[model samples]
Target: MTTLLEARGLTADRPGDEGPVRVLDSVDLALESGTLTELVGPSGAGKTTLLLALARLLPDARGSLALDGVPAEEIDIPAWRMRVALLPQRPTMFAGTVAENLRVPWRLGVRSAESPPDDTALREALDRAGLSGVALERGATRLSVGQAARVALLRVLLTRPRVLLLDEPDASLDDASAEQVRRFTAEFVSGGGAAVRVSHARSDDAADRRVRLTGGRLEEVGRA
Candidate 1:
């Protein structure tokens, strides 16, 4: 398979009272098309930071990131963002109805207006995320965190990004909800898509490769 994403000598640092605080140091990763990779680590291990960097959501720091064999900096930010979507650990939802929140990405220009996904596709995506059509009419603030997470997943799916970045996506879910997320993620990658997920959950089966980050470095742990 072709390489969809690659990071070389990636490093990130933040200003501290005394000096620069290094979060990542010479971290490297490669993700192929149609694969799901997991990034597992303890808190503050730079898992989320790496995801952000790969998605081009983070400001320019050090090293290089390439998407579809092209350097990240060479692509337009908005266009790159459309090709790469990130679902943070705590995803934000609008105050409107569930459907409205799901539609926000399309309405905001992530997807082309000329070829928007149909209602059937949207409903199917929600169903795959373990949600029913009733969720569409419900108020976003009224749904529980787990439901919101599923809705967020559906929202991202609607955009059909080639590369997906998820950060602790299953953190607030119950057993059944987590299983739903796993199944959805698996199906997403099965369809010639690529994903990198950051999670501490040991039970997730969506990832084909597992990586561990510690002390500002990343190392491979397992391969599926």
Candidate 2:
């Protein structure tokens, strides 16, 4: 498989009372096309920090980041984020209907060049996310935690990001809903994209690779 994203010597720091605290230490990772990589670590192990840095959302992070062999600095931040999206642990829903929320990505200047998904496509995606009964006109803010998480995932998918930085997507979901998320992730990678999932459950038997972070450092865990 082709290397879709690569990071070397990645580092990040957060302000502490005494001084800047190291959150990520000289980490290196490679995500390939058509693969899912599971990132496991104890809480506060900097797993989320690494994903933020890779998505260029961490201002205190520094290192070499590349996409498809092109240096990250060479790409615009909005463009880079559009290609490499980070879905936060807590799903966020805007104050609007589901259709409006799903269309939010298209409203952004970064997505101005791309056409938004049609209502039919939106409905189809919702169905795939196990939300067929949820009307597109339903208020997004009224969704339950699990429903919101799936909606958030669907929203990101509609943007067609080349890479997915999933932060505990199944944290609030029930067993069935969590399985739906797993299926979506598997399909995403099989369809030529790549993903890095932060998870604690030992349900990543299908992952192409697994890595664990300890005290801000990373080490390989197992192969497919």
Model 2 lDDT tens row, 61-99: 888999999999899899899999899999999999999
Q: What TM-score number comes out for model 2?
A: 0.97
Clash counts per candidate, in order, are 0, 0
Give all candidate RMSDs, comma-separated.
1.7, 1.0
Worst 10 residues of 1 by lDDT: 109-118
Q: Which candidate has the top score in TM-score?
A: 2
Q: Each prediction's Cα lDDT score?
A: 0.84, 0.92
Candidate 1 lDDT, 1-224, residue by residue in tens: 99988899999886778998788899999989889998988988888888888877766569998888999779888888888889989968898987788888777654655466666776777777778745567898888889888888878877888999988888988988888888878888999889888888654665789999997799999998
How many angstroms is residue 73 displaced in model 1 relative to the true structure, after the best TM-score fit?
2.6
lDDT score for residue 51 of model 1? 86
